[model samples]
Target chain A: MATAAARTFALSAPLPLDNGQSLDGVIVAYETYGELAPGKDNAVLVCHALTGDQYVASTQPLTGKPGWWERMIGPDKPIDTNRFHVICANVIGGCMGSTGPASPAPDGKPYAMRFPVITIRDMVRAEVALLDGLGIERLHAVVGGSMGGMQALSLAANFPARAERVLAIATTARHSAQNIAFHEVGRQAVMADPDWQGGDYYGSGHSPDKGLSVARMAAHITYLSETGLTEKFGRNLQDRDAKSFGFDADFQVESYLRYQGSGFTRRFDANSYLYITRAMDYFDIAEEHGGKLADAFAGTPARFCLVSFDSDWLYPTAESRHVVHALNAAGAPVSFVELSAPFGHDSFLLDVPALDRVVKGFLA
Target chain B: MATAAARTFALSAPLPLDNGQSLDGVIVAYETYGELAPGKDNAVLVCHALTGDQYVASTQPLTGKPGWWERMIGPDKPIDTNRFHVICANVIGGCMGSTGPASPAPDGKPYAMRFPVITIRDMVRAEVALLDGLGIERLHAVVGGSMGGMQALSLAANFPARAERVLAIATTARHSAQNIAFHEVGRQAVMADPDWQGGDYYGSGHSPDKGLSVARMAAHITYLSETGLTEKFGRNLQDRDAKSFGFDADFQVESYLRYQGSGFTRRFDANSYLYITRAMDYFDIAEEHGGKLADAFAGTPARFCLVSFDSDWLYPTAESRHVVHALNAAGAPVSFVELSAPFGHDSFLLDVPALDRVVKGFLA
Candidate 1:
């Protein structure tokens, strides 16, 4: 299980979006594990959240850490690559070898802010094209959490017959005002970095690492619950028993957030952060479907399962309930549950036994 | 009422805070209306929110616009200034003729980041000193909304005998995880500005205006509701009728936010933004009161009135409810109400007739 290798695939073709614009010479980075069934009926697609990539079950090339979803994709795991053909791809508008803001434009310069604002639906559309390119007519299941959940739901709504089962965990159908406000803050942090230089820092000899790190740190806190933070740190002194009485990360949580921010800047591009967050802010499936959330799923045939963490303030249980209510209104087959997790909105990414059981059972 | 002239006061004195820090030669820029009764018992102190100064009923010197809290501080308005002495002072650690990061340090240079980190309690402490200097022993009422509300509540909890009545609107007793996250983003923005140069831009040729503007724009969105934004400007084009297909503030809301950002840069100092926001993020009445919310107000004699707007996600009704619940647990006399306001958190600064009545009645 530990040494299992996944095959990689890269594409260089112009993929068209529903908005009529085509992403020219697109490059999709993907990894697949296990063998496909005789009829390709056991294929599962794993969508990644913002900042995640195709290295779902392998060592990350940049950070040398285990794959982000390593806890849920190996043998005997929830997704269980040994039982189902598992595929994961770096989404478009991302920095991990995908066609994104950090990719070079026709002039061989990084796209920077010039990258077209791609939506979650656009990302799903690209994945569908990838599936088509692979000669896979249908998927056994599509599963994801957070931003990934947005993509999963988009696939179910945009390409209903492509997947038999859909699981969206810790996500909302649309960006709430609070969500937008938070994204705006992050975007502003990136733009404020003078090293950013209007997102044209490609050959400028410097990246907005400080600003980007701070942005990530800010966002990371939302992914953690107050209870989790208090239990873990709770104003505890960092490295010393006494308060430093200065700005040297006096608390353990402060040091932790700073470390998270600094580490994130090493793997993520500032421009990609801006583009991806803007895309999230612009997402509104209900508005696209004429202001009725259920209309987005009209006549959907896929069975849906949604999960939310009780402590997640980013996409709370209320948000998941809204999605379930919309699914019920659409008369779609759906199962919804709110799991008790102390990790806030990012609980799905952590080791949650109940989440694993639900995914394993639902997929089966 | 339209042409009511506001009385101004300028005092330079040393202000001492509870933290044993003394700000020397502090200038208190303030504006007031109506008259002070012979007994000086009808004084109503109006505390301004973050980013707000003391021009609560006068035209602003920078923008030549009406004061922010004019709707709630004018004659026959909320506190009925005609029958009470209204006092509004620019907060300490502010940029408007107050002891702040932009003010000259002892060496005759702008303090920049050298300004000491001041908490909300420290701000109230300065106000108390100002009141003492003005020969007022106690306030008839202390009214504030948002960050100002936090100050009013702190005064009631920290200095129980200072205020007879306290009206706190759209505020919380302590900074939440979400609040701290947002403030962190803003602080990062200021620090990321190249011109900031480690917050020593006093003698530098450039200022961190761009970064400060972006931060302000991000924070401004939190003050308005999603419904209010959609109703005012939905996917509407900024000036042209169709999508420009480029990032040029395509939507009216985007342009509006940019305008707000730019305008804010003209009147506010970037370093001051950092200092004030950090102060807010560090504020915790419970932490100062033995890690118990109820203990903060133990044996407080001030009558408390807490108000919240229904759509305010920044400091939502839930937060107000938490404060009220804590006050109730402490056996404090408190009244709580969630008012329906379309403008969200900014409703406190807008023309809400119901808010006016509530404030007047509470103060009376």
Candidate 2:
């Protein structure tokens, strides 16, 4: 049920990383709902995107906000917690009680910038370890949207037999150049702040809240389409009869974005933001496997469902098609569909009946 | 031809503004090229967009960079200086040798945040005053792209008989909600910095360079299409074998964007950015005319050519179509075309041969 609390798994051994290094004192924060079933075959793994945490169906402790995907992951929803056990993990390099930039180092100080750079594969590897610790051998399905979708694909490709079904919604196998550019802007914004103090702002009187807010504000625009913004707030003045003729939250859209950015800083660690975005930018599944995308899933037995939105210019339908093509070439069972949604890249997070139907049908 | 310098015309009369205020001691920075014919029928008004100056066909004095529209306004080019007398003026709220936020107030101090908020209509009005000062009765054509296109439309609407032909390229009739949102983000970024000092950073030790750079970086991405960035950078390392596993400029695109952001700070004044962007955000021709877009151009005598780039999602083909439909309803002679270009919203400033053809054909 939604009342579940977050739990953590600590592994004694260091986790090997892709960058020829090992991460010590590994920890994964996770939550589970419903019973695992006698065969442990009813377990579904849900991955989170950048800035997302393990509280998929539980209330977030810090902000008291409902689970990010509550509408789709409820009892009778598409994910159907009543029908299956759902496991969601706060990823490595994540801010939510996971072993990340904010976690203590060997010397009892926060890792901060000293945290080892991680890859998407490393995050999945941690998830696998968490699964192993939980005594789960196989997953019924691996489901995620956006960055979470990347994790779903990675789990299926590298550990082919772990999950029988994979659902990737509004995601891509690699980060596009524009994606990296946007991330770079955010990172620069964070670093530019004098308060950042080279990522050592843990005990500082003030955090890089302003810089981080700007970073979030810049990144937030990409999550929406032009038409969506126009329809929702077409030059609509915010609580004013006329323009203030000065810099203020004059437009409703500006006020909304400001709220999103300010609210993010309250729950997120700036250093973790830097680390997670870096991991995403470095995510190129095919680049690791000889530049041939199909090779990553060469022997995968997982059945995959790829869902994309028409207005998702961030990771458009073409990106999903590329993944489906790779699955086809690898002789894997795959279903691909592009749906119409006006919300753009954030469509997967919004209430879309079509997305719900697709998820229910695929998981069934 | 490129050796011409920017000249200023000081108007003795106060200029009226939409905000029920008047701008006093107005100065218009302008430049002219080619020769004025005996009948003055070959005079062309070239409007500059946001951040553009009067150095349309001349070298920019500040950066030593070539004119922004050198390709279009050169002797042998489409808007050929040899064929027509071209006049380009920096808008009133601009920084380059124009009366703007950085310009002295009536008492001889920089206006800073005290500068009167101007509008697209006010900018066109200033250009009209300049034309009157130059003794030009009518323009053969008024040409512009992006914000320049906004100026072109404003000129045609307010001063209907000033120009015979109006060529607005890769632009919209007014600022969309998304457009205002992006500009708001930039303004916020500028104001977030302590160095901005409440928009009076003139004598400050350092300008809000970091914040301004971040703003430029955000705007720069919108000016480029996804495919263009992917082709140009495509995760290509910037002088490195692999990502440093830290937040350095890992990709070429990041480096390129950083350069654009940082370089822009040296040449641009932060206060001018806020004032100019505010003016753009306030632009709404339809809202001004009893909620009818056609009413803005009801009795216009200008022959219009509307050009949109296929990749320019900022001001997409639909936006140009809205203007064209208005022109049709207004019974104005208008031609509309959507051309293919990979440069997104900035295609008009780039070397697009199709644009050249359009300009030449429209002018002829």
Q: Give the top-scoring candidate (DockQ).
A: 2
TM-score of 1: 0.90
Instruction: Output the lDDT of residue B316, model 1.
Output: 85
Candidate 1 residues B19-109, lDDT tens each? 5577787766676677878888888888998899988877888989888877777678776877888888888889877778888889998
Candidate 1 ranges beyond 4 A from true positions: A1-13, A104-109, A176-178, A225-248, A251-253, A285-300, A310-313, A316-331, B1-13, B203-205, B225-245, B289-300, B316-332, B340-342
> Which pairs of residues have clashing backbones in candidate 1?
none
Model 2, range B164-273, lDDT digits (tens) per residue?
99999988877888888788778878887789888888776779998899889988898999998988889899999877887788889999999999999988888888
Evaluated with TM-score, which candidate comes out highest? 2
lDDT of 2: 0.90
Model 2, A1-364: lDDT tens per residue?
Answer: 4557569999768999988999999999999877778988899999998988999988889989889999888788899888889999999999898899889999999999999999999999999998899888999999999999999999998999999999999999999999998899889888887889999999877788888888898888889988898899988899999888777888899899899889999999999899889999999999988999999999998999999999888899999999999999999999999999999899999988999999999999
Report the Cα interface RMSD of each model, rounded to 1 decimal: 3.6, 1.0
lDDT of 2 at A256: 91
Docking class of 2: medium
The fraction of reference interface contacts (C-alpha pairs within 8 A across chains A and B) present in each candidate is: 0.28, 0.80
